[model samples]
Target: MKAKVFIMIMLFVLFLVGCDSEEEVDRKVQDHIMETYGFEVDITYRESLNEGNMGDRIYQVQRKDDPKVEFTVDLMGMWETKIAGDNYEIQEEAFFIGEKFVKKYENELSKLKISNVVFRKSSGLYIETSYNSTISNFKEETLQPLMEFINLLNSYKESEKFEDNYAELDINYSNDKSVQLTQIHEIKTLGQLKEQLYQDLDISNESLKAKDEELFIELENDLRKLGYQYEYGLNSDDPRFESFGCFQEFYENGECNEGYRMYLKGDSLEKDKIFELIQFLNSHSSLIFQDVIISNSKDERIIFEDIKLIKSMADIDTVYSGVNESLGKTILN
Candidate 1:
């Protein structure tokens, strides 16, 4: 009689387990989060329609009572308890805390490919949060810190700029998003990056600063005529740039010489116009100018990228170029 009762109980347990296989996967996910993240949670699964990861089984897990405390775990191999990554995505998204911050900055954040942010939901305050650039041997790996700085700048609105708490920054980039990048990068005269990169190769008969001032004045009028505006650091009247000399070397040679990051864009600028202006800068320059970044000011993306080729502006059809400091000039293709 005892054996029979034990057998019946075992059979009943098996029957319960066998019923509803989908619910079993849910339990496993919930258990995985609880064991792994120490959060007693429920999950909402989403199907991704993205090209590379089509039909991605994305698990959006929320703390049982608190909805704000949420994160995503990608289940690979169809309920095999496999995860794509545990560290990278969350650490990168560390500053995105709640709905208000996310909603306010959605349009701006989307440019960074950050469409949504949800943090450990709390009654109190908390937050969480790629340089695809390839200049100065700066692979995505070496420039993580710089990328973080750029991310912080673009993630905030004008009024809420300092609301996100970060440690004291050593970056030279401007806090004011409205400020043009040209004005803030450095002060001094820079007609082209090569003049400063190889200071010994000075071809200037006049003060490079004076030349820069003259050149920009002429360029500004022409830019406006072409519906373009200097997006970074070229505000001639701003007092911050009063001391800026165009001929100074701010970065180490060859490793990271950002020669004249003068991004020209306008509210009415179209994609074709970016190429036109870049080509204009390319062929028009008297000095050895490389790494002329033609970008969408609003998006802050390199419309043209550098591929380490060696081509002149006249031959530049698709790629961009930058001086290697050690190797002189290389192009992007």
Candidate 2:
């Protein structure tokens, strides 16, 4: 009878150990990922019994704040990582925004691509970036600590202790010019983050406005040199302007079919003057300058009914006179 009881106790202990072993696998995997990537994760494990034997053990892992970004690891099989949800898609979109932001001020910023950001309790924050063929040229001088601030108000998960956060920036680029960039920032306080985000946006807006003003001045000078008296305005809010490409192929070859209408309050209203303006532009190889309507001070509208016809009518001899004169002077010297 004692032998029978001891056998039963041994079986019970074995059952408990089996259950704990399964749970231990899940915990160890989660802990490994947390330590490797510095992300806090929630993990759950389940085991199935088939034919009176334990089946595959499944582990589900999720980032603390990003439940949608979940992964499943099977300990019985090859232990392959499987991802679910739209986390990759969301991260891709954020990467595109980061790419544009970097390109907008590339001359001032480093040439790097940002991939994604990871926030951690132990290591603070980290950014992940990848390059295709080579590394990026990122520097601390360009990306100030203020630029690393990321607002988590609209994030997948909300945290009460957000202020105990730091940030990491990742920049990736390739020799082929492909880049991905991401920024991970710790949340110190919701209000503080919101305020800092708004402040940064405001500063960026002001800087862009200043750059636009400078470009407008340059454009005005060019137009004035071409004998055009006009008041010009920029339609930056127009969606079409967002993808506008003022290249020769876009205007002449139908590669880019979009058109832009420039509204102007000008002094010139004569047909001859309009023709001269068109001819001059053509001589300067402004082939993409089409679909433009010039309105004068008297509300007179001038349109280039046939851009090709106007281009053909421009005098080649007159257009090349300056070039020929320069060549002649060079020859004489």
Candidate 3:
């Protein structure tokens, strides 16, 4: 009887040991699988419109490996804004009447709108102004000299005034390629000269003299071709203008914000569009900062200087469902 009892105790100890070993093996396998195919996601949730209570949670997904994957929960109807323009590269003192005088002169003398544009691409100073003619405007003779200047600037890490002759566009193409030569200039005045004399004066059609109008039309057609809704804005605050690449929108708070929105055809910018935009905003709240960074990586950072990240939450599932039902779904698939 004593020998049988001892044997039974030994058997019980073996069973427990086997069970523990199995558990350990299972845990390790699970951990390895999780490490292999899993993704670490940081999700931030906002609690209220004004209460501003927000929280972030880290989640492990089974199959995402891209380190740069971003998921946005857009709440407000904010879409990306398309900005097009040129950069100014002239000296404040180089102009006969100084920088202010040059600017005023350009605004008064020139037909195309010359706002504060800077087009320095590893070069001294080149501007991208919308020419009166649209023939994919670069050539070898016109751009070569400017590119050489730009190369010099990159190498020196300094800004030096090229000779008045240095500002000339000497485009030369060894191969068959369209190079925009006329649009580049070392100074605003020189660029204006190139645009007016070679670019504008060369155009035979008198009707095409108006570049700003032509550009607006081109923008309209391009947006339409891209399947975006388009319309002219009579009222300054109309959101429809946003769809046409206008970023200025005034709010009730007496502050100005820059953003754009586009909608499907037959959709109202105020009703269905607003809700859709709101959903996009909510989903992409975190992306706002990143978008700014990417869009203006070469310039000054976009400071939402006065804007506050207020908290807000509606039922996300409900908002998403409503968007799908109303928008009829996007063509991303």
Candidate 4:
């Protein structure tokens, strides 16, 4: 009789061990949440049984650090038999903080609209102006040249003798590759800046003029070798050597149209030649002058428009997009 009682006790203990309890599941979920988010959490599980012994269990988890943040995990189960089958399957997982969904709460920056950016060149300052009342300053190391240019402008601003350069920049933000930029500089200030840059290069105005005349001859010879005829002329109104422009006309299908108009400017004609030659070599592979006005043909216009600058600005837009993505992942997530 004692042997029979011992056997029954052993069987009862085994049955209790075989049954899956809500406490066991809650402990597993609590451990998982703490390991994943570095937060201690409390998990409570409740189960309901159906007619065929198929039932669902809901695990409600609350962050111990913040009771307001909570989530739920739903587990579905099916029984092959009343006592033997306890096959549990996870039905759904959801997270919430207060009344808001966790996933939506994490990606808040994805909804941000970046409207405009203001680039100030004085003292190397590049500031992302207010967006939703938030202004951000860029890292100085990343924009050294821009900061230097801004510093130069600021220094000039403090100097009473140096005239202020009135400049205007028109930037057209676009969704596609087509971007337009127009920059206008005061003629006097532009001339002064050119003179200062040339002085730094140790090239006098007269020497630069002579070098330009030589470059024109070499350019014409290069064009002739490439089976092209060119006409070179200086704008009579702006008699400066830098104002020289070349025009090439090609007769195609009995119609005469301008083929290429090249202009060289700046302190060193040699530097300009090198740049133009490199560009000419790569012209076949890419668009050489995609909406870029290299120089002003007439003295009346003192504008410098570069497609390359537009590309640089586009890169800034990309950086902003990355910033938004990072903010979403770190702060909201």
Candidate with best lDDT: 1
Estimate, for each residue in 1-333, the C-alpha lDDT of model 4 and write its tens digit: 999999999987875675556555556555666555677756544445453545455566556774334445555543311222111111011111111221322233123322233332222222221223211111222123222333333443345233323233222222221111122222234333332323221122222334355554665466445433222243233334333322212322211122222443222222233244334533533223222122212321111122232233333333234543321111111
Pairs of colliding residues, candidate 4? 106-332, 121-150, 122-150, 123-150, 123-151, 124-147
Whole-model lDDT per candidate: 0.43, 0.40, 0.30, 0.34
Off by over 4 Å in 1: 1-207, 236-259, 268-270, 285-288, 295-297, 303-333
Q: Candidate 3: worst 10 consecutive residues by lDDT?
A: 288-297
Cα lDDT of model 2 by residue, 233-309, tens digit: 44344423321123233332222233322334457655466666666544533223344455665655554422434
| Candidate achieving the largest TM-score | 2
Evaluation by lDDT, superior candidate among 2 and 3: 2
Residue 236 shift from truth in candidate 3, angstroms: 21
lDDT of 2: 0.40
How much is 185 displaced in model 1, in angstroms? 33
Q: What is the C-alpha lDDT profile of model 1 across 1-333, one tens digit per residue?
A: 999999999987876554435565577667777677666766665554233653356677655764445566666552233555333234324434346566765666555443334333222223333122221221333234344334444344335653434322222212221111222123222222322323321222113434456776777677778777665555555534332232335234322233343555565434355556655665556423434444343554443333133244433432323323332222223
Candidate 2 — which residues are off by over 4 angstroms?
Answer: 1-111, 115-219, 225-264, 285-288, 311-333
Give residue 31's lDDT in candidate 2 (0 to 100). 65
Per-candidate Cα RMSD to the true structure, in Å, reads 17.9, 20.8, 26.2, 26.7
